[model samples]
Target: MQPLILHIPHASTHIPFKDGYLVGEELLQQEINKLTDWYTDDLFDSPEDITIKADFSRIFCDVERFVDDQQEVMAQYGMGMLYTHTDAGQRMREVNPTLRKQIKEEYYLPHHQKLEVAVKKQLDQFGHALMVDCHSFTDIPFERDLNKKVPRPDINIGTDPFHTSQTLQDLTLEFFTSRGFSVGLNWPYSGTMVPMAYYQKNRQVQSILIEVNRKLYLDAVTCTRNRHFNEIKSVLNQYLHLIRSNVNDIFYPINNES
Candidate 1:
């Protein structure tokens, strides 16, 4: 068991649309800059053996969402499995059922399948898997964001009632706060990622979403890492160490002394 599986769903600016459904290249780049979790993948680095990253941008296909619209809440906002609107609540492109289905099959399903495989492999070997859902948000919330009015903290830890363990949650909060980060629990964003099959059924599949606010380490205007980039990454490395060291204590008490 690798003990940790980092699930980085965003951070790619590559939008592979050769047809040019978007109005202009400038608009596309604006949307990408606004929506992409810029430099988050680098910030959330760790020595985890299992990592499932989506190389394609979320604007193309959001793998974290439920494939079925009825089950996905973000579908109402036109930002479900396949985005129908931009972050500013404007039309990005028209996605018909056929296109939606194609995107789902091509990008969405494959990323999730990889995640499922990684998680199951860990569970089979160690009887437990700790999934760290990595993400980052802008300091200013987008127009389409549900919690636009809420002031997001420097570090937001999203958790699911079913899959997030209390011990892991406590350690996570402590780790970030001790480093002088203002932490929020599911404020700007809620819901942690768990493979749909084991989502509500398996308690051994522990998961947590660590959302770092971009203002801390990213130059929002230029879409680049600031001087604080390495500082934040170093702190995250320490945080990972803490979580890894206590894996036995938190998830496998029987092997605490082993």
Candidate 2:
């Protein structure tokens, strides 16, 4: 059966300009400048794939479109442009955490809810499903990027690794390392983004979070997709195959759904 994989495209904080939203902004040149120096150059100065730039461009465009306004979109981040005169922006800054939580529930809860429906539908036909939640983070946190970005790590494979079986954890670590990734065991982000969000409904639903460092795929400042991205994707394919073969042996399903 084809696995039910749901990749969550990153939703970053919106930057509110005093004027308002910048519609249909082209960001390729901005990315080209920011990406030329950092991790991309360090890993692969020259890569064979031509499609890598396209991926970055797509993400750049979509982010602008997704959060189309200041008041509404900035709320997604519990932040706003500096407005010393206005209470709304200051209020947004003050209750940021609470607002952020609410936004997560608003945005992510629906995603999970939809996923539960979709996975269950797939299960009705296939009897089981596998979900690999895909994400990318930075090697280090970007604290003051004009473009607000949550800090990330080189690699984080979150699967409730401590709570679950050791064999599965080992397989995941070894498999990813073998597939050409510098791996980590939840140093930056823990298991909640994985099993807790999408796979929380039941153990029958096997879930693994693949947190790739943004450095692995793109430029930090420009939001450019790295030349090496295609290589990473290729390696991931092989790793996924290994997981598919060993699902029965490795995944210990938590069948009890709350």
Candidate 3:
């Protein structure tokens, strides 16, 4: 069946957050592993909240790492500051350029591109479609705030920063707000790397990348399921329903009144 709404949860770089050997991501993974089960069976499942594994692997620790353990430097290789090593202007030498390219092609690009093409295909079948990129981030301060782990806003709305319809944005804000979620606008996150379709304004479809603060349902240090996981999940299911019902109005203003 064609899908009117598409969600692209940005494919993670497999870099676990760590301090030295283990990065901060390891802590976060603990939380996700509880729910997703370490990429086992289904992409995600809730079958009895079963057992999972947590072995150490630096592979999931960084995306474009240029150094190895014991400070062995990788020879220079790649492009500008964007895709290059942590050191600005330094190409990650000796690092398999082919593998890095494959990571982007196989992991990141294809995943999102597939969603885009899927949305386009569906747009032809249906009148309108929307893509909402779902993501999560720690609400903890960058300066290592181990204390105030309070869950941030219940909802964050981004309408491509007023590039999309302001009416639609306002309506979206109201939609979430009415459902008893505390909403935030462009706070903690606005948007990043959201490619624009050549015919965005003309097309009868819409795409918005929405990032959720991960701290909502996971503890800051342990990354384990917090008390609010189910509560937040319940809200999201309803939010999806609201957006689907109201989407047509965003494109056809006449239909909104009718």
The candidate maximizing TM-score is: 1
| Comparing 1 and 3 on lDDT, the stronger one | 1
Candidate rank order under TM-score = 1, 3, 2
Compared with the true structure, model 3 gives a TM-score of 0.59
Better of 2 and 3 by lDDT: 2
User: In lDDT terms, which candidate is top?
Assistant: 1
Score each candidate by Cα lDDT.
Answer: 0.83, 0.46, 0.44
Q: Candidate 3 lDDT, tens digit per residue, 151-172?
A: 5675556556423555567777
Model 1 Cα RMSD, 1 decimal: 2.6
Kindly list the per-residue Cα lDDT of model 1 for residues 1-258, writing each as its tens digit. 355889998888877663425557788788888888887778877656467899998877788888888998989887888877777677777877788777778778888899999988888988888888999998898887878755679998999987877788899999888888999898888889999879888888888999999999999889989999999999887887788888866676423523
Candidate 2, which ten residues in sequence have the lowest lDDT sum?
Answer: 49-58
- In order of appearance, the predictions have TM-scores of 0.94, 0.55, 0.59
- Candidate 1, superposed: residue stretches over 4 Å from native: 18-20, 252-258
Every model: Cα RMSD to truth: 2.6, 9.5, 9.3
Candidate number with the higher lDDT (1 or 2): 1
For model 2, the stretches where C-alpha displacement exceeds 4 angstroms are: 9-110, 144-153, 161-165, 192-201, 252-258
* Candidate 3 runs further than 4 Å off: 11-96, 143-152, 161-163, 192-203, 254-258
Backbone collision count in every prediction? Answer: 0, 3, 18
Clashing pairs in 2: 137-214, 203-254, 217-226
